[model samples]
Target chain A: MKQRERLIEALLALSAGISVLTTGGIIVMLAVEAAHFFRQVPLGTFLTDTQWTPLFADKHFGILPLVSGTLLTTGVAIAVALPLGLIIAIYLNEYATVGFRNVIKPLLEVLAAVPTVVYGFFALTVVTPFLQRLIPGMAGFNALSAGSVMGIMILPLVSSLSEDALTAVPRSLREASYALGATRLQTAMRVVVPAASSGITVSVILAISRAVGETMIVAIAAGQEPRLTANPLVPVETITTYIVQVSSGDVAYGTLEYDTIFAAGITLFVLTLVLNNVGYWFRQKFREQYE
Target chain B: MSNMTRNRLLDGAFRAVGLLATLLGLLLLAVFLLDILRTGLSRLSWQFLSALPSRFPERAGIYTALLGTVWIMVLTALIAVPVGLAAGVYLEEYGRKSRWSALLEINITNLAGVPSVIYGLLGLNIFVRFLRMGSSVLAASCTLALLILPILIVATREAIRAVPKTLREASFALGATRWQTIWYQVLPASMGAFLRELFWPCRGRWAKRPRCSCWGCWPTCRLRQKAPWTSFRRCPFKYSTGFRAPSRHSESTPPPLLLCCCSLRLG
Candidate 1:
């Protein structure tokens, strides 16, 4: 009996260790390939140069254009997601009846479950045309439509996380505010929201990280022009989009052009890692205060 | 009295704005579904379900793609469910507060935040290149299994944690081993939550297209056609190929609509 128990424990421990292995695999795989890439391209050129045409003969390898494109779309996405998500979260947590909340919460989850590919198609086929009608000179593939649709995609992330934070704010705080003659609006805005502010900030940062790393939506709808422009009306290429584009093609392994993706992958990995750690830290601090 | 009226008016206005914001999400979903239904309903026939890819848009069918999707789903479930459940069982039932387990906990949380695209890169390097899986369905399934592991593990841990301690104590009193107690008492008690948790990863693997596409899962359809279970490489969202031709909207629109309906039902 003791021997069997030891065997089972060993098996279960190995299963749990696979997660650690996966993290190690990601770091090592990215680091080794990115090392090969950095050998040829100077770190300065990779960060500072304004162009990113590695596929071309001239071989300029600046990552700024892609960074700008990523920032531009992320800026648009956060703009659309932040206010709308917060408002919806506020409505659901503070105002809605229990029955209404029950119905709406699952529906919001369904929205999140819908594939990013479908959203990419929607951004391409539906949103771009709608925007073109509204604003002349909107390119067929522009950042505005892609970013807006992406905002809607990540909206659930924001709303749900913020709602969880708001729900975690103790009910006694609200009663105290009411006891002090504060209106419902004043209590929700001043008391609950302030109390949940760190949690909300974590959600927004995590949502931004998601937006930065989103692939198909930007790849399909945001055009593949690696230009250093912030105008949403024009086309731009992001880091994930560039990776997808390269992977789809028949780029030979071990080539500098192929290695560019790993270089780009490391950049994306570092960025999302920093955002996630920050969010995790904030959540830890917030939980300590409450629990 | 005026101050009270002003406060009431502002509260009412905020309520109105909040309601509108909440409704906007539902509205977007409705519009998207309506558009898909209007375009795809007529083309969704038995013929569309049974046919294979053809150069002619009118003759193109989603049979091969559907087969590939089934293969991916079955294989991913086979690989991910067991490992994830085991990890969950260990963490909830057996893990002590050691530094190693603490590190395991933190690693899983951070892995949850790593982007899906990065997972694609990992698969490209590890499975496709190093292991020489040749971008087969097995490779794609393995990548997706890894991709969904963090989510499944977290869900399993929550479900297992929710199992009442009294049941375990009862089993222990009966002279059961730790594994037996978990298998018979805790797992059965938490089975409902476990099944519900299974739904998310299953739907997630179904909806995920880009990562598989990055692994070159599509091109193999044209190259290798031997076994649907082993080397099949058609992505369900290859409907995007049909979408390229605006006039063939009927051929392409139904598959994704069908995919959406099936996934929603699964959810």
Candidate 2:
């Protein structure tokens, strides 16, 4: 019996050990490669410079363009996804019958299950073609098309999270709004949306983080130009796309060119980590209030 | 028109807009399934399933990718299940109501939200580079195992927490040790739920493999006709998730047809 008890304890310890090791090892590798990158290119050059031509002969290493491109695509994606996602959540929670919600929810989940690569293909084949007719000279691989498809790709995240948030808002709140002679839309837009603001905000932030870290879509659809422009129609590149471009190239090990990918990765990692923490904090706070 | 007429018009417009939004969101799913079926189904004969990715796209079967996915999935399940179950046990039974446990609880919830691609980068650095696993299937599988680790942990914890405390007290009163009480009484009571919690994420993780399209969806589709027991009895935990055993049933297979239509559109 003592031996059996010891075995269980050992298993518990073992799991914790594995989790910590995995986290630790990832951080260490990122740090090691980043250290190598910083040694070759000064920290100021990587962070503050505007141009990011690593593959060229004159190898400029300012990361602003990549950062802006990531922000731009994410910005456009949020603009498209958030309002639609929120409205869908509102409709599902406040207006739809239980039967309707059940059907819609699983379908939305199926949307989430579709791989990001498929979205890239959709952007390339379907979205880009549609957009090119509206905006002339919209490149085959423009950020706008990629951003729209990405918005669709992460729609489930926003809608599902916001729906969960909206569902958590007490029924009494909606009843009170209705008792005040508010319309259904008013009850949704004013009372429920405000009540669920924190959760919805966290969901939006989480979506932004996803857009920022997304690799496959932007890699395939968003062009590889590291321009700092905010033009949505023209081709633009993201940090993740830049990383893919560099990695896909024939850079030898330990070169500044190779190290640039790690530098970009660190930037991507830090942004996502911060956003994830913020999202988590909101979810916790909101959940605590309701509980 | 009267005010009543105007109000009805407004409601109709709102409903129309809502329906349109829902359809818009669901369209890609339809398009995806339609696209895959249009392209892949005619070509997905037995020959295709049994073959591997060839240099020629025409001859490219998903055999290696499928086997690799299965191999990775089996390993991920073996590695994640026991550890996740144990962690769940710890959080649910041993540490319930503790402040530290609550904190860990929140952390796990947040951990599950991190993007899959970030997990890829994490895998590239941690498993492939640091551990020298290269870009082999093993590294990818381990990466995914860690990716879904938090989900399994949270689900199992929820399952164990759902077990009645009365069961625990009963065992303790009968002179059972804490571990014995948990293992024999609490766990067995929650066993069905635990299996379910483990299976969903495991299935998802397997499907998330870079190479393979999921087969779980296939069994849910056309294959259930021959072996009605295949869906539920094949995997006990899957039964609770509304996967009715194919055996001992009527001659209908409506759900799989619907599922196939859905998968066809969404693929």
User: Which tens-of-lDDT digit does each residue in B1-267 have in candidate 1?
Assistant: 698899888889989999999899889988988877876787888888899877776898878877877787788789999999999889888896988889998898788777777888888788777887767677777877887787778778777877889999999999999999998899989988777665642222211111112211122111222343464544444654444567776567776577677667666
Interface RMSD of each: 5.3, 8.9
Off by over 4 Å in 1: A288-291, B200-231, B240-248
At residue B90, candidate 1 shows an lDDT of: 90
DockQ of the two-chain complex in candidate 2: 0.15
**Residue A51: error of model 2 in Å?**
1.7
Residue lDDT tens for model 1, A1-291: 899999999999999999999999999999999999999999999999999999999999999998899999999999989999999999899899989987887687666666666777788889999999999988998899999998987787788778877888999999999999888899999999999998789889888988998887888789888999989999999998888778766788899999999999899899989988888887777652655
- Candidate number of the best TM-score: 1
Residue B3's lDDT in candidate 2:
68
lDDT of 2 by residue, A70-180 (tens): 998898888878877887888888779999998887677665555455456557756888888988777887889889888886777788778877988998889998898
Q: Pick the candidate with the highest DockQ.
A: 1
Q: Candidate 2: what lDDT?
A: 0.66
